[model samples]
Target: MTITSKGRLTLSVAAFATIAAGACAEPSEELIAAARAEGMLTTIALPHSWCGYGEVIQAFKDKYGIEVNELNPNAGSADELEAVKANRGNTGPQAPDVLDVGLSFGPTAKEQGLLQPYKVSTWDSIPADAKDDEGYWYGDYYGVLGFAVNNDIFPDAPQSFAELKDGQFANSVALQGDPRTGNSVMMAVYAAGIAEGGEPGADALNKGIAFFKELKESGNYVPVNGSAQNIAQGTTPIYFDWDYNLLAMRDKLDGNPPVSVVVPTDAVIAGVYVQAISAHAPHPNAAKLWMEYLYSDEGQLGWLKGYCHPIRFNDMAERGVIPQELLDNLPPAENYARAIFPTLPEQSEAKDAVAANWGSEMGVQ
Candidate 1:
């Protein structure tokens, strides 16, 4: 039983807990009713612009009539983990019920006992490498690294990592954040390392660090947060970020210089973000419902509209569940299918390696 501002009510935690345990019995109707009774779900670190979450949240509201209170929309993966830990046992709107974070962060959150294990109905459809066996976290979608260039500034944008080092893009290359903290920046380094002939392992990031060091010494490598506005204003003409983000920027900033996204032929690195429920979620049932919806056909297609490749994409395509037009709008499917993906251990090791050497090797704080 729990009491809200509206009134006092009784809830069956056992039944809902069973649903979260991925039991053999179906509890969809019960879960829906309970979530509706709660009438709200709180989430953190979901930027409306990233991966079509703006439309996804709206669609969830329209279907369930459950209000979603999104907190710290721009928070990063670390921030999301801290929010859950700090707000544990507090039943309030600020206590996040769900979390979406970098793949490596999922295991960290679980290790810290901040996540709840809950498998959606479509669990079997998700790839084994992308999910936890106990279901504490699962990959929602993935994106490959790319260069988003402002064509107005450089008519011939740097098409490869080799080109970026030729002094042509001096003082123009912008990374989103410190590789020590930002997953995107870290993966940018990973991709660069692979391009520099480093092996596909965590230790190989040293080569990427060396490449960036050379780039910085050559008067390139601007240490500024890259944004669509920054690109439009020519502050950072060459931005390294995810293909989905760069592609979305092209659509978002439609006419101002026009954004062009390119996947460098030398190296392709892919990263995934996973979804999990907070261990102390104030709205557990709603969180479960949200996961269920995300893995559903409608939710997966919603992410596709935002240029993200859903985890179940191939399965849906094989079954012909995805619309033809949506399929047509995506970038070359081979680009994503053929890219290299690091294992969880490798990702964790790489993140730690960058955190240890980013400042000393890259000369950026």
Candidate 2:
């Protein structure tokens, strides 16, 4: 979280460019001073184990003296929104300071008036689609939708979505649980649609549904969470895992043979996660300040360590945070050149579509 002096963060769109030039050289002294004056922060993560977040939060606390209280470690996007609605206009002792959520949800949340806007100075560098037009939320780390192949399981691994749909891999592939249940998985549907001609501004996800239908006919998918453990133990052959999970798994295996991550030759879905501040944030100033830091060069670099593609902020890539090895693991910067980020308006429609038609359209609850 950060300090919001008169509802403004330390960094500004005009200053983001200069600040990126020398953030670590001399941290934002002005920003930190503002945070000190504000005094506290609260953060919310839609609860995974927060393996990377653990280190990030510790540093935030140590540097700012703000308690980064992360509530609802296991909640989903829906849960967070409900909290926002329940606590509408109440940035009290129990309200949230910050929120961690999917890219699609950022627009949905902002459109619903559930969020507050803070355009980090790096705002100019960020792609227009990845963040809200009004700065309702800013995407941090994001990944492309891809199929994770286990070299051990398929003698001749599939190379494309079409191959995954081929009958040869019957009962071998795993669905990313239900789109109804997993936000990351849900975005994949939108991404897969891009492969099927669902261009920008298309309201229909029928292409996505068709692809899944073919997979179903192939009997290639098993209902399960993104449990890479299944692959490690040979319980499942392949699943739709992220680049980081596959890379981290390879690192642990001591060799790359057991797993491989791929970016489909067809269009890649732009699945992203974003950060937002509460409209009723008690530490509104602190929350805003935290956003400034989070979007700063120093902050964006933190995700490079987590194996995520940092949102483009003030040409952040020029910095030395990403070494050669990590860059190799990433699907070449060029692959991201064509990636599709969600808009708030598009996301609102998609979320509603998923909720209203997922069961009948995709056999998902």
Candidate 3:
């Protein structure tokens, strides 16, 4: 099924509806009652802006009438795991019932017995490779690395990773978080390595470290964590993050200083973020309900509106459920045609390499 510029799919709506009607069942009434009785779900490391989560969360609340207690919106994947560990015995508001973390963190969390398994109703639609057979965790959405530039600060945005090294961007480029712990930051380094012609595994990671080392040495890399406020304030004029994040930030900024999101032409590295229920959840039923909502068509569309490619995008597209406007608003589909999705082992290896070497090798901590 091809997604043309017109945002139309080749699959007939009648054919898809017949298949989808039987496939997409509503959440069970018993589950809804149980979730409502629980009343709330605690979640960690979910930023309102990332993947259009603000809208998604609100929608879930509106639909289920369950309060969502969000914790540490800016925390990274490692932080999310630590939160679960720190609050294992606590059922208070501080405890996180759900986690949305980097793909590599899923298996690690499960191995550590930090996650509980509960497959959503739409689990079959998820690609087999993107989910664990036991349903401990599943890929939610994906996006490629890109640069979000404050146009007011840098009139001519850098179109590629190579361009970021130029002296013209001195003290301007910044990663969204610390590479030592942040998934997106680590992936940014991987993307850089790929752009520098390094092979995809350890070699690319090492080269990526070298690339950042040079950037820091040349005074082009800003040590501060980048955020939407930082971009508007011109503190981190060129921020490295997922394409969806930058696009969402651009929309939120609304031309104030005018943000420009560029998917680097040199290398396009796609990363998937997964969702899981915590093993020690205070509101297990609510957490399950939240997962059910996220995998639903409405929830998937929310992420798409935020510029993320939902994990079940192909399925929805085939079903002709995705809105044409959402498809039209996305960055050129060609930009993602070359996106490289690293394997689980590759991501784990690269993540470990960054965690161990980022501080010593780049001296950026």
Candidate 4:
């Protein structure tokens, strides 16, 4: 991802609407309800590659019978977070109506006084672990963390990190990036811990560090931002990435050669893509409406079509919405239960570790 001096980043237009920026107004039910009645919605968010945003974006318009005017719908999580922070909490013009960010950054944003809360109608469907206790942010579509291997490169794609580092895969491997900046990579670490012990109680962090360190030494480390194209081409034979990207890339390259994606036998870590009303939003009502629809059954089903795992597993199964390909690739619903969100404390701990240990351990700044 590229950043400018203003610190603004461009994501796909859909991502901007998913968790990006739109507008801001004074917080008021009357003001928001009036806007909803007027049939107008302006929003911002992050885009998913599986073409998921369009489904829900259109749904919002149909459900509310509104004219949607979403702006800056092309920015990364950091871009969205900065935009919300820059705009929210102001009287006018400077605030965004809502915010959508990644799970790891949600706590950081909330702790910095960047978000406000509104419990949607379908809140019950969302696991308590996915939403903020104070309602600051809510998890929407989720991705399971795992290793995506180019089977063409590795005749035997290793199922565990130990095998990954010690095998012939050494020179062909790639790690997404830093845990703090990369959601999937962080989940990989957490998943490794879960595989070694269990999350919030396991000692996988140290093991992950050791494994990655050795992975780096093995000359297999592809440290670039995870590129599905690169992975498909075998520059990165063994890579860690989100399930959706892995699945999408595999399908996209299926004709080229066989590509493999798996939920590592040891564990899985569910990373929640989050949504929050920006502290300084131009359309708070629209933001709220968007949140409501996102949690609705119709919207949740849209998630499955886009190849993302909806937060409501039973709902997806009952609707028969989970795809056979994805289902076949999954470990189990119980495996997803291993999902964890980064908290303020976890952020602090990771920061200290990255500062105190990552550079020397992983050879990254």
TM-score of each: 0.90, 0.78, 0.94, 0.74
Order of candidate numbers by lDDT, starting with the best: 3, 1, 2, 4
What are the root-mean-square deviations of the candidates from the true structure over C-alphas?
A: 9.5, 7.2, 3.2, 9.7
Cα deviation of 118 in candidate 3 (Å)?
0.8
Give the candidate number with the greatest TM-score. 3
Q: Is candidate 1 or candidate 3 better by lDDT?
A: 3
Q: What is the Cα-based TM-score of model 1? A: 0.90
Give me the candidate number with maximum lDDT.
3
In model 2, which regions exceed 4 Å deviation?
1-21, 24-40, 46-52, 87-95, 124-130, 197-204, 249-257, 318-329, 342-346
| 1-365 per-residue lDDT for model 4 (tens digits) | 01012222333333433331121122345645766774555555444454266666776677566677654655556666777666645545434566656676778788887777788766765778777888888777777776777767676777765566565665677766666555556567656655666444224455566666766777666676556777766777777877776776677676466776777766655666777876655666777777766766556656655667767655445434334453554445554565554454554454445335656777667
lDDT tens digits by residue: candidate 2, 1-365: 11011221333334443555564433367877777776778676533223245556765677678776677765666667777778766756557778878767776778788888887776776777567778889777776666676787786667667677777687777755666545666666666676777754334455666677777766876555555677666555777745554555556665434777777777666667788987778787788777777676655655555566677522554443333443554557655676666665666566666666667865765
Clashes of each: 0, 9, 0, 39
Backbone steric clashes in candidate 4, count: 39
Candidates sorted by TM-score, best first: 3, 1, 2, 4
The local lDDT score (0 to 100) that residue 313 gets in candidate 4 is: 53
On TM-score, the stronger of 2 and 3 is 3
Better of 1 and 2 by lDDT: 1
Candidate 4 at residue 364, lDDT? 66
